[model samples]
Target: MAGDRDWWFDEAAGPLIRPYAMTRGRTRPGAPNLNLVTQIRASRNRSDLSQLTPEHQEIVDLCERPLSVAEIAAYLNIPLVVAKILISDLLELGDVVAGAPFQTSDIVDTKFLQAVLDGIRRI
Candidate 1:
């Protein structure tokens, strides 16, 4: 019955492969265009995708509607860096397009912060 259970996750079986192994210990991709919120889209011409690994194709399929790198990572249950590497690979293969997200930065208001602090002190 011990053999009946899945061995992929069994540490004693020596069958577990670390997620970073697929990336060959690469923490950062060579691509500089990738960011957490950058959108990815399947290219109109996906012929290049045929030469890629099935995993890459799956990633492309997920990007058919333009999902951000973070969304892809969350949906696939993979690390953010892994998703970036995948996206970078797809970009190199011309199978995916990277789109810029709207840039916005929060401006802190000192008066609002003080008022919130005062309200909290009263409570």
Candidate 2:
């Protein structure tokens, strides 16, 4: 019986809560501009912490140093849509502020990336 139940709650399995449950089944973010490059940061007003779920609070903490929507999703190990929904909730509550998407210069620079890769190879 123990072996039969082991697969159900394996050590490799993640959180018990379904991803949809965290967003209350919301697949889309209320704010439409939350793209992968959009930057998020915690706001000065954190008085509404009690109103936030644990996932939302985690986003707030992660955003303290200004993180991208994609980064937040990666850090939380959740889907991008799920992270966006959580961020949307915090936005509505004034817990976090969203910044403009990361912009790139007209000219591309592959040299910097190549240098870093070479340094890693050397190590």
lDDT of each: 0.76, 0.83
lDDT of 2 by residue, 1-123 (tens): 234334434457864668889889888999899999899999998756867777888789888898999999988778899999999988888899999865555327878767878999999
For model 1, the local distance difference test gives 0.76
**TM-score for each predicted model, relative to the true structure:** 0.64, 0.72
In model 1, the runs with Cα more than 4 Å from the true position are: 1-17, 102-123
User: At residue 15, what lDDT does model 1 achieve?
Assistant: 30
Which candidate should be chosen as best, given lDDT against the real structure? 2
Per residue, candidate 1 scores C-alpha lDDT tens digits across 7-110 of: 44465544365667756688887688788889899998776656776457778988889899999887655688888887888888788999887443343677
How large an RMSD does model 2 have? 7.3
Best by TM-score: 2
